[model samples]
Target: MTEASMRFEEGEGFARRMDAEDPLRSFREEFLFPQSPQGEPLVYLAGNSLGLQPRRAQQYVQEEMEDWARLGVEGHFHARRPWLPYHENLTGQTARLVGALPLEVVVMNTLSVNLHLMMVSFYRPTRERFKILIEGGAFPSDQYAVASQARFHGFDPKDAVLKLEPRAGEDTLRTEDILETLERHGSEIALVLLGNVNYLTGQAFDMKALTQAAHARGCRVGFDLAHGAGNLRLSLHDDGPDFAVWCSYKYLNGGPGALGGVFIHERHARAEGLPRFEGWWGNDKAIRFQMGPDFVPLPGAEGWQLSNPPIFQLAALRASMELFDRATMPSLRGKGDRLTGYLEFLLDRLPSGFVRITTPRDVKARGSQLSLRFSKDPRRLLTRLSEAGVCCDFRSPDIIRAAPAPLYNSFQDVYRFVKVLESHARD
Candidate 1:
């Protein structure tokens, strides 16, 4: 449906009609939602923070357990899905989800671990160009990782890290301002790292444009796709960023603390003399089991692996990826746009001075999340939401982030959440 035809209205009936008309509505049954003490499912709107567990995840994980118990050591080679090359099972689906070549993507360690690993190769700092550019107020983990990386290279974080801040009184960064910043400081930058979608304000960046601009300045570019992976229709290969990393627990619905993913551009697949911290698994497969002292790296993203992945994590993720492969990112992203648009429409009708959306109004500039900036003590509002059986997250100081994931969240979920907000505002 076109944006004009969405014709969003503020009532339960309208929400039910939209849910009925939704082509992807059946996908909701694939997930298991949290229940209240009264036995009703909570209106889950926090897919930006943690996605609901996929029902099939339990079954998949159980199969792996059964294999381990029945086969023991032999499971590595004889399990239903061999453990030795198990991560490979996820490669095609992960690559397609993020718009990458299979060779460029790998399921690996947690997000921060992969970020540091990517930095080992891509954040090659030199005397003349030593600064790393990132958006101000990046997710705390990223800020910590970038700061420590600079410190590891004997440079002060203050000098090595440059942050891009929004314009005065603005909540989100403008594309022109970002491009101009790159042009102005391009020569001094060694790496340009950004969250593909800002976790706080739910601002989505122009990866392709930024990559072109950064490359023109001779800077290596990377992104933290923690918020972008499943929420947005990414073109990681076409966008031409050097590398990117993301955790699977959130929109990917890989279960709590599930494995992370990495993407390295094909251009750097076999770049000679590229420095990295290598492990036995990263060695070329033919020689890997030969147990050579020398690390003969595999081509592309798989070459960055530090160790064999946990089988249970891979099993859980396999379940989620199978669902994604069937549903597809394009279809999921389309539904996401409509869901968030309906949410924004309902929110705009709330009492004007009570709260304001910090996320960009332009649909193209955001994913599913809408961050509400409250004028009062937001914690009180959070309490109200919790009591009402609404599930969303609070970001420090004063913001409540709600993301209506299209894969499982219905239009009725969005309507119900707003009704709670409406009730709180009236009080």
Candidate 2:
């Protein structure tokens, strides 16, 4: 293309035009963006880290506050969206977002906590085959939770945790290499836990193939959907993993520290009794108030709950889930690919080694986030990006993660981010 045509294609005006034509453009008004001290939008793009708060989040929280003031404890049953069946309202929508039946999903505790709870029931380890196989660069919280679970089960983490690192001198793990490791260690691996989309590099693993391979080896499998829940197209039920866990605080837009969700395959929901860490909430809903010592576990994913649900967090989550219901994951995934591709195109136009995209280039192999590795000091580039109001995330050592969430982020956001990044590179 001629210089004139190239300039026309990448100009700020072009970004504005793209935003104008965007189907999700109206959704941007739904979020409460962070502001500078001067009170302007901070150009927020870190939705993969923690999504922007939905405007309705305050109303959801206030509804509970009002209920507490008016109905007191009776609000559990009397409040609008009664706290008694509050989680039920979210279950169907949450399941739909991840492409599962209502019976397969539950919205409850925080992410790491839910992972441990699921492990309690699913990670049934024996003396001969008791190790957990996981990706090498897992989120620290996940590593900590898995290690703690191993210790809780009387196994040493150093011996029971089998980490799969990338091949030498590579940033991302190859799919073949991961499958080979699973095949080689299949017999001894009691559980195979991995991230659907890696938090750092944005590499999305193929869940269906991986789950099938793990199951063939007689190993239980689970996924941390923290980065993939709303950012990628996931059919949890069809994928057929033993279990999964994710936090709504990220792509689900449920505000900071929002309630996390868990999924249990339908097969296990009715299978002969299994061991689980239980609480009164896990008891049968019909006789929960009967206060019997006998714990009759509910039939599905709800059977895993361990305590009274967090009403306030659930409220915010409900608000966010409603938004996700209106915007489905498949549609979001389509836009995510284009936005990230635009980012890659822009980054590629820069001078050699100014920035390198560590995230996989295959659209099918990544979510919305792109990890930018800088030739200059990463911290310095981070400061420059911040000063320019292009909000993003930084992983230690050297990576900037910018996620353009289709729910609220526009193509214009991606264009602006690249403009700032290119300017910084030149500086």
Superposition-based RMSD of candidate 2 using all C-alpha atoms, in angstroms: 2.9
- Clashing residue pairs in all predictions, respectively, total 0, 0
lDDT by residue (127-208, candidate 2, tens digit) is 9889999888999998998898889889999999999898888889998988998889899899999999999989999999
RMSD of each: 1.0, 2.9
Model 1 vs. true fold: TM = 0.98
Return the lDDT, model 1, position 101.
100
Error of 1 at 260 (Å): 0.5
**lDDT computed for candidate 2:** 0.86
Residue runs of model 2 more than 4 Å from their true location after superposition: 1-8
What tens-digit string does per-residue lDDT give for candidate 1 at 1-427? 7553567787889989989988888899999999965588989999888888999999989999999999998999999999999999999999999999999999999999999999999998898899999999799899999999999999999999999999999999999998998999999999999998999999999999999999999999999999999999999999999999999999999988989999999999999899999998999999888898999999999999989999999999998899899999999988998999999999899988988999998888899999999887789989888888898999788899999999999999999898888888888
* Local distance difference test, each candidate: 0.93, 0.86
TM-score of each: 0.98, 0.96
After aligning candidate 1 to the native by TM-score, how far in Å is the CA of 201 from where it should be?
A: 0.3
